[model samples]
Target: MTYAITQTCCADATCVAVCPVNCIHPTPEERDFGSTEMLHIDPKTCIDCGACADACPVDAIFPVESLSAAQREYGPLNAAYYEGREAGSVTSGPNFHAWGEPVFERVLPSGFAPVRVAVVGTGPAGMYAVEDLLLHTGAEVTLIDRLPVAGGLIRYGVAPDHPSTKKVQDVFARFHAHPRVRMHLGLDVGKDVTHRELAAHHDAVVYAVGAGADRRLSVPGEDLPGSLSARTF
Candidate 1:
């Protein structure tokens, strides 16, 4: 049996770093890491170490034996990522930076004091909010994302070919890389860290989460498989 990284599992690589046998694939450092929706555990190599479960901040990791019926599909989904792997499959390079590294550079106005702020989502809104906050105050920013990686919909929801729009992720990378900012990746505020915890840690909490679902088209066959909303598409 093996532990499966679930829908809530962020592709942050915390589990990958902790795994003794290196069973997890598409670690944040890998090229495909940024593109992957979530981290996938290699069941064949898992050894049932439980390191992944321990490392996961959102508690998204679960042993196969203990997986609820709803989560059972994740077991195959994780393995499917490496289905075609030959003896020597090429691996992608790391796409994300370490906690303290500079992902980008920013200019600030003179005489600013660090403000303590917590911004959620790490998407365009979150990135822009943090950027504005940084310029306005000397803020100790904590950027939180449910996924292991920071970029939100830009990483998961966006189409890969949309490079122009995807550039926004770079902006977020730099914001996260900022010295004043502390990126709390994989931390789901309500779960890994609570609202109260955030209130105690920061002077204010700014929620940048986007709208969850779009207004339905309200037409026939809208529920069919071919139908997709702007957000879903």
Candidate 2:
């Protein structure tokens, strides 16, 4: 079976850059690039070399045979993307540079007003969403976090020595100063403030709360001082 792109794909296009056969459709250069929800692998043309899988930073690509139950549908979804393409649509090779950068313009409806959104977390994901929304719309964003200090696990979990990895924090920190973006720190949504409260203040509430929990082991001393999660270590 061919490789498939799953839900975790943020459309960074790293897979397209490394793919040898150029079987992945909708390269950033294509007309439907930003319009499509996710990138798709051409099952018919994919050589299944697994290069794209290696290049994916988020591990969103998988060989069809190895797909988990939740990711199985991605195989068909990848195939479906190609079905909608025009008959003559095909990329030559390594045309990612040709795609150029995505240009977004705000197209508002008549009598419309600026939207308001309350994001539940201030981590990379939430901030990235804020950055994307601000670039596309005239929306006011309220970033809510339970901790007194922001940055989430990125500030606490990442090693101090890894400067390059943590450098992304600097980029995210800029949103805090944006006029349309507001920060609500030391505020728990359910305990400090109700969901209804946020709903009354905004058009939508987005939960970008990251997955940082440590799973349990049946062995003794699992909670000992020496024991630590990878996220904490």
- TM-scores across all candidates? 0.46, 0.57
lDDT of each: 0.74, 0.80
What is the RMSD of candidate 1? 13.4
lDDT of 1 by residue, 165-191 (tens): 465466457777788888877787788
* lDDT minimum window of 10 residues, candidate 1: 88-97
lDDT of 2 by residue, 1-233 (tens): 69999876767677888877778767887787877778999887787689998877557789999999977899999998878665334566654223446664668896788899999988877887899888788899999998888787667777887554465567678889899998989998899999998899899899987864777777989888898877767
Off by over 4 Å in 2: 1-106
Task: Please give the lDDT score at residue 209 for candidate 1.
Answer: 76
Clash count for candidate 1 is 11
Clashes of each: 11, 1
| Candidate 2: residue 222 lDDT (0-100) | 87
